[model samples]
Target: MMEVPRDLFIPPDALEVFLDTFQGPLDLLLYLIRKHNLEVLDIPMAELTRQYMAYVEIMRANQLELAAEYLLMTALLIEIKSRMLLPRPIIRTNEDDLDPRAELMRRLLEYEQMKLAAQRLNDIPQVERDFTLVQVLIEQTVAKRLPEVNVDDLRNAWITLVVRAQVNRHHRVTRAELSVRSHMSRIMRDLRGREFIEFNELFGPSAGVAEVVVTFLALLELVKESLVEISQSQPIGIIYVKSTDFLTSV
Candidate 1:
């Protein structure tokens, strides 16, 4: 079994449904009239008073706090209902022949107009009510400040970075096959009959890094085998490459 706290103080009318819409009691009356399709000009006082009393009784049963104005309106409705019961003169007179609901109807019409006007005014969004007003403040100075970064800009930047990382992802390393033996044969053909060939002539201008490394290794192997000679005429002078066949002939 669950036990409630000793400090839990619930009010008698804590669970209350608020019916205070755009109009208060008048609005309730208007709603009843409209729902029943009763003409505002020729209101039936008996039915109106009965419905009003039923609502008042519900509020009373629920121990709802009532306003003096609500009680006054209730009394006025009863008086109108009673006046309707009173006998009228056989010969009709001005104002006396009018319905007892005339004054209440006049107020209801005026109240309805005001309510409609208020609703129209409420519908047209005003500052700080329906939407948040965005104001961009610009400060004037010799050194102008850069625009502030908003969440949307930051989010877009993050998305761009993710896309670029995916497109240019360097996760895989591919190994290319280059042969030093092939580069060696290429060098032998280039240095075939040359006594002194400029060092740069043996290498292509558009050689890739892998090809350049292979060519350098091939040149080193030729020099180790005493098949090619590399020489510089003077200090910091242009280097030259030559075959040992020329030196052997000399």
Candidate 2:
């Protein structure tokens, strides 16, 4: 029995077919020419142009908007065809010989290079892995013990933060009088529904520099009132403010 060959042609109208498959007019033309096994250097513009126009017609008939650039390239192909038909005096210089297909070939090569480069970049590991302390898991039989350095350091840090937030009751006020209690009330009102606020961004351009100092004091009062939590994961790191309003009732 004789085996029949299957049709290899892909139908132009596939559902949800991404236009990205064809980079541009040049890419589409190249695909058609290659599919038919035609010579690139001597591309029969009349046949190629007809094939290209068929695609354009298919797109328009399907209510797909054809880009202006595709039309411009169609005009270019017609112009090149007309130029080839006209018998013009060829300039013969020993130094250079310019092929009519040179420009198109150059563009194709550049596009191909960029395509490969993009593929290579995509293949690279995107999410970088950083070693974390908790990743050190040991065998079940091994009697492993971990150091308590993080706990000790955290305890010392908590003590320091508490000490820093305490107001110096003995110090007398000079120049201007300010109360942390009033500032705390203002902050609580501002953050009633908001879950978080940047520690430094609460102030505006017109805000006096003293507002920063007052805000810090307000934050301390809020932390003490159990209405908010203040924390920094690392020294000189970004300070975080989380609403503990839910914890207040508990």
Provide the overall lDDT of each model, using Cα atoms, as 2-decimal numbers: 0.70, 0.62
Candidate 2 accuracy as lDDT: 0.62
Estimate, for each residue in 24-127, the C-alpha lDDT of model 2 and write its tens digit: 88777777777778877677877877787776766666676777888887887777677667665687575335555567667766776787899898887665
Off by over 4 Å in 1: 1-23, 137-250
Candidate 1 has its poorest 10 consecutive residues by lDDT at 1-10
On the 0 to 100 scale, the lDDT of residue 193 in model 2 is 78
Q: Give the lDDT of residue 129 in candidate 2.
A: 44
In lDDT terms, which candidate is top? 1
Query: After TM-score superposition, what is the CA distance of residue 175 in candidate 2 from its true location, in Å?
Result: 96
| lDDT of candidate 1 over 159-224, digit per residue (tens) | 444454455545555676879888878888888877777666665554555555677788879878
Query: What TM-score does prediction 1 earn?
Result: 0.47
Per-candidate TM-scores read 0.47, 0.40
